[model samples]
Target: MRSRHVSVWIDAPPDVVYAFAADPHELSRWAAGLAEGSLRPSADGWVADSPMGQVTVQFSPPNTFGVLDHVVRLPSGEEVDNPMRVVAAAPGAAQSEVVFTVRQRPGISDEDFDADIAAVTADLQTLRGILEGQ
Candidate 1:
């Protein structure tokens, strides 16, 4: 599988950024590519409407390592793993870098892969704007 990492630098501490990004409730504010205002708590995770239809999103447990990995189950019963992270740009730095990794499945075309990358980039930009109060 091919993967692309889309990132944004937020002018906030890693912990702050991680707290916001790791919360499924905050996804409506910045994760336009994944969920809008349609996210709600489900029995196992969160359910949201995506371009592809309804999806179930399950995130990794909160931890100090800043890992925000998640699995999104599509309407077609396929699950996609989304790897994300929030880390200090530099040691002891106040700023944080948020990275989202998008992976291309075996049958995806180049154009589709590019569009996926673009969507992730836009989502990260939105996250930065919200976090930095831009």
Candidate 2:
């Protein structure tokens, strides 16, 4: 149940970042570790071919609080909760700080956990690049 928070700073407003990140259609653009180009709408949620296998992603309802929390159901039927958020870097700032929590599953090794963190970091960086038009 151990977890780590991976975050990135984007030169965009929080609302903009949240809007983009919360959209399932835009997941493949940055969240390659989870969706790549295989994400599509499903009756239950969005399904994607992830590194682990096929996964069903269910996102939280849209809101103004910048919460982008989601649940990913693995092919094995295990649901992984992913907590994410976009917030203003400073009070009334135009910049945003995107954070993703990476949790270590019961049987994961240290190396694997670190790799997961690295993957999340890379995804966040890609999101930043896209939003900042780099």
Candidate with maximal lDDT: 2
How does candidate 2 score on lDDT?
Answer: 0.92
Error in Å for residue 97 of model 1: 0.7
Tens-digit lDDT track of model 2 for 7-43: 9999998989999999898999999889858578899
Worst 10 residues of 1 by lDDT: 31-40
lDDT (tens digit, per residue) of candidate 1 on 70-119:
99998988889999999898888999989889999888999999999998
**Model 1, 116: alpha-carbon shift in Å?**
0.6
Backbone clash tally for model 2? 0
Against the hidden reference, what TM-scores do the models get?
Answer: 0.95, 0.96
RMSD of 1: 1.0
